[model samples]
Target: MPIAFTVTYAVFAFILGSVIGSFLNVVILRTPEKMSIVTEPSHCFSCGHRLAWYDMFPIFSYIFLRGRCRYCGEKFSPRYMVVELITAVIYCLSYLVFAVFQPADWWKIAFSAVMFPVLIVLSMIDIDRFEIPYWCSAVMAVLGIAAIFVFPSEIVWYERLIAMGVILVLFAVLVLIGGMGGGDMQLMIGASLLLGYRVFAGLLIGILFGAIYGSIKKLRDSKAEKQLTEQIRDIAEQWYKNQLDRGVGYVADERSDVIVGSISDGAPDIEWEFLDEKVWVGLPDKSELSRMLRQNITDEREGGFKIFISGADVKKVKYSRRMVFGPFLAVGIAVSWFVGAQIVDWYTNLF
Candidate 1:
């Protein structure tokens, strides 16, 4: 409880977070690729130059390097540095909230400290790839299961079970209805076990943020959607026409070696690259395709062009394939863990 001890722990938390964050950069970059996280040394993405230890020292390394590759001089993204800073903050805050600032529970602090990196992994992986890695959720479930024995809350065991069951049901419905991915549901289920009734607060917060972002994104994407309407229609028309005229099939998935598919089979086959089958129609018209294909946005708002000429007019369509829920759900989970008890209490007090 001494001020000196609290400061020391906070410092330790920040330093540890920075080191973990450095490793997390590798995890984020490699996991989606199925690359071994431990085998590969850190290297310049643009050039095959291996980085030294000093070059990998978290935030300071980025600052020293001026955000450019020291070997290739290619300007790298600041996101790596941002990740480290965010991780540092998360650890520092976790210690302060669970240990120093609030109840000095080392157990809670340890749980949260572990949670900080797991969350960073989840959030970054989701952002980089629209899909959430099952392993992250698995780790989370393991942590939650451990919590049942290690740091059980005051909530009745039955209540915790009911809350987790309720959340699982709700998430199952959402997944079946097609708004969310199974991974998000799995993460929620784990979170529910750890958070109990408080998981509702997390869901609410997640939904709120997802909606707000979806709304903003919808507005921004409207133009791209408008442009894509013609492009999709044109591609579909050409593709169908080619099939009709030639009586042959050019599979959508394989247009070229470099380009995986005309539009890369809806599931991200490659990272940071898009191969639209429309290119086969002719050289792809960039005007029709938004640069942000990694978003895994199959269609935009205002209904994408109908791929098939059917009962519905080609011009008329419906918005399908909304935003990714993983990142938003992560946001909610973090917020809930931090303040869900307070939120639940405040709501209950109003009754």
Candidate 2:
């Protein structure tokens, strides 16, 4: 419990965290692309310059190189530095708060330290790709199961099981209602098994943050759409005019001007992955529509031919974009891991 010992362990934690953060950057970049994380050497995305040893020293390298590739001079995103710094600081804080305070409590600190990278990877991957890797959730669930055997938790065994069941059912309902994603549900189930009733605090915290963020995002997207819709509409209008000149006229109340033969309007639109299941042969652009219109001119006797695109496809392009929830849930999970017991204790005391 000496001050000197605490400082030394904190420093060690920071170094360890920085190293892990460096590896996590690679995972975040490659995992979504299905690229080999270990075999592939780190290279500049723009210039394809393989990073030298000196250029790969986590936060320091980014700083010394002025956040640019050493060879190509292409500036790197500040995210690299932020990730390293956040990880280092969190690790240091974990050591000082949980480990150093009680020399015998290294296990708790170790668990928290290990979870940092997992949460970071999940958050970043979710940001990049809307899907959360099932493996991450499985790892979390496995850790929870291990904790049940290895550590003595205050929450009873049945409570953990019940919590897991409740969360799964509740989140399944939310997913059906479009309030949550399938990935978020999986994560919550894992978290519930790990944290028991205290997982509710995590859900509350996550939903609190998510709702605030969702509001901001909704407003931002709405404003951007207002500006962007005008521009895209101008293009669409020009495209429609071109189609009209090619003997394709407007329908009575059609959603889109350009249509393809294979796609259907009546079928279920969004697949479970939240992607429109269509191989985009070409855009519904002016030139493409004109070509298609001319090609489909076999029915010239039936007045001006009109191509009616599926409303779903039109909405996917102009109106729909999936919202991300994994990052918020990950944040909640991290918070719950750190202080869920404390939160429960404080709440009980309040009563």
RMSD of each: 8.2, 8.9
Task: Give the Å shift of residue 9 in candidate 1.
Answer: 1.6
Clash count for each candidate, listed in order shown: 4, 0
lDDT of each: 0.70, 0.69
TM-score of each model, paired residue for residue: 0.79, 0.75
lDDT of 1 by residue, 250-302 (tens): 32332321221223234222221544444343343333233333243453332
lDDT tens readout by residue for model 2, 1-351: 678886787788898888888888988888877899899888898899888878999899999999999888999999988888888888887877676554557676767777778878888877766768888888788777766765655577788889899998889888987757788888888888788888988888898899999888878667654543443344445555554455444322334333322111212121123222252222334346444434433322111111233433232224323567898988888788778888988999998
Clash tally for model 2: 0
lDDT for model 1, on a 0 to 1 scale?
Answer: 0.70
- Candidate 1 lowest-lDDT run of ten: 304-313
- Cα error of candidate 2 at position 345, Å: 2.2
Q: Residue 57 in model 2: shift from native, Å?
A: 0.4
